[model samples]
Target: MAGNSDPLTPRAKLAVTAGKAVAAASRAAGRGSGSVIGGRVALKLDPDLLARLAQNLDVVLVSATNGKTTTTRLIAEALRAAGPVVSNALGANMPAGITSALAGGSDAKYGVIEVDEKYLAGVARDTDPKCIALLNLSRDQLDRAAETRMLAENWREGLAGSKAVIVANADDPLVVWAASSSPNVIWVAAGQMWKDDAWSCPACGGVMQRPGDDWFCGECGFRRPTPTWALSGDHVLDPHGSAWPIHLQLPGRANKANAASSAAVAAVFGVPPQVALERMYQVQAVAGRYDVVQFQGRDLRLLLAKNPAGWLETFSLIDPPPTPVILSVNARGADGTDTSWLWDVDYTRLTGHPIFVIGDRKLDLAVRLEVANQHFQVCENLDQAVQMCPPGRIEVIANYTAFQDLRRRVGN
Candidate 1:
């Protein structure tokens, strides 16, 4: 605290004190010190508290360009089938969010977290978890996070000497290249016939290309073996009874990769392929990530598009324009300061007419919608937008903050 000069520094201390109070209450209720409150108090003080907790437990970290929350939840659930577990199910990937989550669980032998790529190095250095799962690397939020290479470099430097078991997507040139030298590595490649957009090898940058069959480094010839487990057959089954015959719960091909990564983690935790598939199929979506809701007799789809990959996935989920959508974008600090990544998303795919649009940056979304030859009724608030929309097929797309407000409004 030597360099801490601001009086507002009380935030951390206040959070810690409140955490201790929760811990005492849990203890009074017959729970142990390992309960949520106690764990949170430790996290608040340790900043890297989760890693310290991992030193003595089975710590599994899930990070990715997309599907981190869903994969984290899926893996946590699968492991919970074995025993007690803890996770950041609220989709807070930052340090404070993580601290809040760990401080809330009790007697959990397993700690599963969905960490953001930008925070991976700090979290890894502090947590030293037993397992680290890197789902994939894609062009996302270039304004906030540097290109994917920066994140990969940080991962390489941060995990250089750790004894963590690295679980990676072999198909992703970045992930495979990062863990190539590690002895304790588990590579999970997507099945054949899966589309590949891997452009260059993040390590050598020698036009790392994926030939027709699988991924092969054009420069180093560093080829990755096929995934041990792949999503086979023409149909995918979901927990909410939605079936994707040669499709997925989320709209695009990228979610398929996310699902594969989740299954790989489940496999390592001793979940049988069939059982994992059954349990996986049972999961429809996590909050803010294409989570479908039935709002007043209408199909309300909630999609969180924080980054480019996420936006593309959202675009793929729907067919065309006239789908009746309500899109919101929050330019608030909590949602990140920059919104330039919006240019990377293919909004041209939107051919449907939207009923209502709202956000701090509603004009931004309106412009995007207008350029796509679609106009929407602009509203001042998310609640108003939800209320204004006709009680029929509706899709609510939002960024982080707007989605939070939307969730509260819709009671989801």
Candidate 2:
């Protein structure tokens, strides 16, 4: 604790002690991971506990509509190449989960946190992080969280005078508008797949004009900034114009885009692009995402695509046509509680595949699939759904809760 004048206060220590005990109890109970409950208890004991725990550590917060957990893991892996790093690896992004992560990693010097889009402002305010990464934003959990535009506005106000260097996706207009206000910003051209959310400018409500990869607003002059880093097809280019080919164990084009953002964020923490990319290649899966588990005499590749924006990227990752694809839908609070977002996704992309619908919201998915002129069989649960399909390799795409459910039953 040399050169550290402000150690944890008495109240904060008590809070941490109480939180850890509850967390241990929770883990022993077999109810859940205890990431949220433990941190929630800590916050209740001392409102300033999060700030105090994060005071010594260099923090980086990653936020986006999709890829929050994966990007956070990639960034953490990159940073770990340089030093001991801590993170909420369980896909917990709230204050409670983040606090629990910080509390548990007392020995680590660097902390990379995955933050919920709505909670980013508060976490940034509390943690006083050195860097922040804003990935693409789209309509997700509309019933629970604010629209992408409102989240951008909040991000603008929350990070207005912050001293942190923001590593942002230049390809996303919403991310651009949110991070542009920051004094130090590194723009990375990591492509955006969903354009429906960014058609109108968040600044002036003017129509966004997209000429190739660049986006601009004519009315108020809001535009996509020139990126110092970019993803050109299969490679990621650094600020020095050096192209690095990314060989990741993680799958899909979207994961590659996510890695590009993670490398940029890691560089700010003294981890070079080469070292970052090398370390990132070692991460095979993120919280069971893209993890292929052998279950019931078949290979089940599990993936999470919770919304329209996520679904758009997810479809490209799956095996084409004849592959049996199981689409699991859930409208639980954790999954956004609105099945209308299903209609926003083009179910037609999955037409050629042998589609089997499963989960609590199977009926809702069936209706959307029917409307799209795609034929599908709706099963009540995952086991029955999987049994109905011919078993060799099956592609399973689920929303938030549905993915977690499958991971527990099959992935374990």
Candidate number achieving the greatest lDDT relative to the actual structure: 2
Could you give the C-alpha RMSD of every candidate to the true structure, in order shown? 7.9, 1.4
Residue 280 Cα positional deviation in candidate 2, in Å, after optimal superposition = 0.6
| lDDT for position 140 in model 1 | 61
**TM-score top scorer:** 2
Q: Each model's TM-score, in the order given?
A: 0.78, 0.97
lDDT of 2 at 179: 91
Candidate 1: regions farther than 4 A off: 1-52, 103-106, 191-198, 208-217, 220-225, 233-256, 281-284, 294-297, 319-321, 353-356, 375-377, 383-391
State the C-alpha lDDT per candidate: 0.66, 0.89
Off by over 4 Å in 2: 1-5
lDDT of 2 by residue, 140-204 (tens): 88798887889899999999988999999999998989998899999999999889999999889
How far off is residue 61 in model 1, in Å?
0.6
What is candidate 1's lDDT per residue for 58-101, written digit by digit as tens?
67888877678888877786677666777888667766566656
